[model samples]
Target: MPIYEAIYRSNDHEELITVNSIEQHEKFVDVKNHLYCTYQGCTARLSYVPKGKVRAHFKTWPKNNHIQDCTDYFERMVTANKQKSIATSTMALSDKHIKSVLDNLKRKRKEQESGTDKVKTNRKKKPRPKVNPDSFENTTLNIVPTTGPEADLTSGENNIKEPSVRNRSLINLSDDDLNWTRSVECYIQNVETDDNRAVLELRDGNYTFRVFFEEFFFDNAPINFRGYFEDLKYLVQRHKEYLFSGVGLIEKRNEQYCMLVNRGNDFRIDDQYIAIFLQNASA
Candidate 1:
């Protein structure tokens, strides 16, 4: 039996709602009447397996006759075929069949190369804009302090205040704010580290911003402060909840906002910070 943990209810719907959306044993009570397999021409009723019973998931009804030849059924058939192929190493082949296979490989290689060449020829490089150093010489960087319930003392540090301003979504930032320092609290969705830099993809609701960290900052940071970066990386990789604070330089690339953080900026991470920055933005 092929077990599916998620399924679409309608053709027009884009998101997958899991059986875990409902409480344990409440799945049937809540959505049994509404559930349906998304596959066309299949009228299989999805059975919800609640939590604590071999993990919560959705499975096809045992007596679903329509699902015998559906997409999931075909996938299982393909998987079984692959397993059979792997198990049998020796297969008889005629000389003509071998020649046809070699010709197909050559044709595929030529098509791939031609496609790569076309992509290279059509790609255009955008020039980098020159920056004027004088424009930032006398700029006064304003630090806005966060207030209300979400502005409480964060974990791992004492006396540092969280920002209170609510309009910190990436979509709300503009090109005019470039080089200006602003505080944004975002959830770390992704983290990537390389030899020279570390990048963090952060999200506050539908808005997303990238945080850039240069290798110099980590290498030159004091020993006490250096551990914060490692801790942050671990938390983000584990998908743990935390609020990130830093003085960000907003840059617009392809109409999307990205923040650049360099050495000496106030970058802080606190898992105990319970204030929802997204809720404030919406309010």
Candidate 2:
């Protein structure tokens, strides 16, 4: 039998009514008369199945032809129900744990507040440097300064240029060098991913660029890159306003600049740098 937790009623202004919306079976029975399958062209009578060991829910009439052909059929509904059950269970567990921890912290805070009538003489506040918005305006990032054999290897055929006053920031990188590697500091504004590619949109003050990583293949099958992408996604989502540092290949498309970071490149969450940057930005 096909069952659901929700049904659509067109006569009462086309609203979806879930099992949670009604308190009694009699009310559900009343609404059931006006209810219809939300799927288009599906004429199956949605029944309020309140009996048996399974959870009470809405189900389609048995042996209905439209129910068999509908997109919101039995199998899909069961899958969605299972997913919802799991999510609900996980959230309940998380809520219990969080409540316990929060209660403990509140108790501790109250105790501390009650006992802290004495002022600590050694406490001090550090003065912050004022940031000028004009300093970031029209500013450019010079090539990271390098020394010794590292400098020589990066120079010459490696296409690495020395730190100069003339060089532009990563957002202004040109298409002249496709393989050139450069270090950049930027806040990741957004991260998006699909089956084959991950794109990161980064911003530094008023400048912005995108970083793309296409899926690589091995043994004729596409490798799962979700783990790597998830790690980046977690960091960006947790610290949406913080800055990150990475070495990336410069690319240009449609007269716009972009950077590409692959397995060989270095990417790091720059906590200290972000703190300074945020301080400066607010100053």
Candidate 3:
């Protein structure tokens, strides 16, 4: 989420601050004070991005903590809706499911605000995990195959083998079967640099699927493309295991399958609230 305003908290005072205001009074602000998402009940830290070619703004990290009903929280929802409106035919998840989830969360928030929910009370916020940069220095990448027939790594332009089941691993899906709506797992094989673009390769069994982060990819992305792409590279390089869930169309080019990650909410890395790999990656 591209947060514009943030909550500045200190021992003596708490106040709402906007990116513009922060810039206006940059020298007078206390950097040591805690900066959080402006929305009530949201604990996501908002890092200030000073004005450059673009205007100053607040940015959330990969490990952001936002309440489900926060406006910043709905950025992903906006992406989902935008994707649906633009390409309803390619979407895998049902609209009804998304709407139901939103409605339930809104109702729950309302109940808590009205003092109707007795089970809920003010509780201490969980401490954010500390990441150690030295830990991932010498880590070896390990990819565990799913329990089934050993994936055949056949040599050819089209390495995918037709899965007997409709809902199957991503690598096991053929060009024709990419439209089915389901949660499928794939192994993070590699991240490669292709000219000005980035390519993420996911493998299952012997077949590898590629997702290209090119111009079209950036057009649909919700965050800063360059910064987020760097974060993704760092994430994949540091973590050995992660899961990516999203909605997109699968295109076959030159006998190879490529996944189009066209929306912000269309995918999650490690079942995280956001797309970047933040959950358990440091651990």
Provide the TM-score for each candidate, comma-separated.
0.34, 0.32, 0.38
In lDDT terms, which candidate is top?
A: 3
- What's the lDDT for candidate 3? 0.51
Error of 2 at 174 (Å): 3.9
Indicate whether candidate 2 or candidate 3 has the larger lDDT.
3
Give model 3's TM-score versus the native structure: 0.38
lDDT of 1 by residue, 1-283 (tens): 4344445454564334565553332233335434657667776677654432144556766555445667665322222222221211111222233234334434444666688422222235453444453433333222332211132233212333222222244434555466444445566887777656677788865567888766555566454334445555665677656656555456666666776655433454541211233233226
> Clashing residue pairs, candidate 3?
246-266
lDDT of 3 by residue, 31-121 (tens): 3136788777778777665543245577775466578897877332222222221211111233333333334444544776798854433
Candidate 3 Cα misplacement greater than 4 A, ranges: 1-167, 178-183, 193-196, 279-283
- Candidate 1 has which clashing residue pairs, if any? 146-163, 146-164
Consecutive 10-residue window with the lowest summed lDDT within model 1: 83-92
When 1 and 3 are scored with lDDT, the better candidate is 3
Residue 51 lDDT in model 2?
26
Q: How well is each residue in 76-128 modelled by candidate 2, as lDDT tens digits?
A: 22222222212110001122322333344344346667995332333354534
lDDT of each: 0.48, 0.49, 0.51
How many pairs of residues in model 1 come into backbone collision? 2
Q: Which ranges in model 1 have alpha carbons more than 4 Å from their true place?
A: 1-167, 223-230, 271-283
